[model samples]
Target chain A: MATCCGGLKLDPAVREDARRRLLSVRGHVDAVLRMLENDRVYCVDVLKQVKAVDGALAKVGNLVLQSHLKQHVVTAHERGDEDQILGELMEILKYR
Target chain B: MATCCGGLKLDPAVREDARRRLLSVRGHVDAVLRMLENDRVYCVDVLKQVKAVDGALAKVGNLVLQSHLKQHVVTAHERGDEDQILGELMEILKYR
Candidate 1:
C-alpha cells in the first residue's frame, strides 16, 4: 500500500480505476470537440455530452473521496491527524 | 448562420470558445492521470483538480445554454418551435 500526503493510503485498485475512468473522460472530451468542429451539432446535443463528461468526473471524485474516507477518516484519531483530515474533507466539500 | 437541430443557432464565437475550453479540459484530465500514475498525490489534491475540471465543464455548458437562450429560446414563438425549445430546455435541466 503506497502512502499519499499525510501518509494516507489510497488503494491501488481504486487508483487504477480512477485512472481508467479519467482516460475515458479524456476521450469523451475529444469526441465532443470533434462534434463541435465537424458536425453541425445541436446546442442541446452538445449540452448532453458536456453533462455526461461532468457526470463521469463526479463519479471519479466520488471514488477518491470514498477511498479517503474509508482509509483515512476512519483511523484519523488513532493516527492523531483528525483535525487535518477533517479540514481536508471540508476543503473538498467546499468545492462541491 | 448555420442552424442546428430545430433550426437553432449557436454563435460561432461561442462554439470556438467552447472548443478551446474543452481542449484545455482534455489536457487537464491528462495531467490528473499523470499525477495519479506518478505522484503520490493526496486525495484532497486530486479532488481539487477534479473539481476544477467540473467547473470548466460547467462554464462551457453555460456558454452553450446562454447561446441557446439568446438565439433560440427568445425567438421560439416567432420560429414556431416553442414546444421543441421548451422540451430541450427541460431535458437539459433533468440531467442537472
Candidate 2:
C-alpha cells in the first residue's frame, strides 16, 4: 500500500506491463510527429500511421484503467468510500 | 497555409469542431480520474465510465485526423511532396 496515495499499489507485474505499454505509446506519438514534418509522405499514408498511434494509445489507456481498478477501487470498497468516489466520477463525466 | 508549420491551416469550421471535440474528451478524462479516487463506487460502474471516456477520445482522434488530412495532406500534394510524406507515414506505422 502507498500511504501517500492512500490506495493499494499496482501489482509489480501490472506495473511493468503498464510501463512498457506507455513507452510504446510514446514511441508511436513521436513517429507520427516526424511523419507530419516530412514533406514527401502522402496524406493517406499519414492517416494510416495516425490510426496506429491511436490504437497504441487506447491500449495504454486500458493498462491504466486496469491498474486503477486493482489498486484503488478494490481498496476503497473495504474502506467504505465507494459511494463518494462514484459521485466524483460522475461529476467528472458531466462535461456539459 | 501556415509557414511556421509549413502546412495548410485548418478551416475555421473544422478548427471549431476540433476545439469542441477536444474539450468534450477532456471532460471525460477528468470524470474518469474522479471515479478512480472515489471509494464507494463499484468497480464495474467505474469500468463503464472508462469505456465512455475511451469512446469520446476516439471521436476526438477522428477530428484531428480529418483536420490534418484536409489541411496538411492536400497542401503537401500540391507541393509535390506526397512521396516523401508517404514514406514518413509508413515509417511511423512500423512500430513493432
Q: Output the number of the TM-score-best candidate.
A: 1
TM-score of each model's chain B:
0.88, 0.68
lDDT of 2 by residue, B1-96 (tens): 112233444355544554465455555545544544444443335445555655654564566566666666666678887786566445644642
Model 2, A1-96: lDDT tens digits are 112233434455544554465456545545544544544443444445446655765664566556666666666678887886556446534541
What TM-score should be assigned to candidate 2? 0.48
Off by over 4 Å in 2: A1-61, A64-96, B1-4, B91-96
Interface RMSD to the true structure, each candidate: 3.8, 8.6
DockQ of each: 0.52, 0.09
Best by DockQ: 1
- Residues A1-96, candidate 1: write the lDDT tens digits: 223556665667888999999999998999899878844667888888899889999999999999989978898999999998898789889947
**CA lDDT, candidate 2, residue A3:** 21
In model 1, how large is the Cα lDDT of residue B32?
Answer: 88
- DockQ, model 1, C-alpha based: 0.52
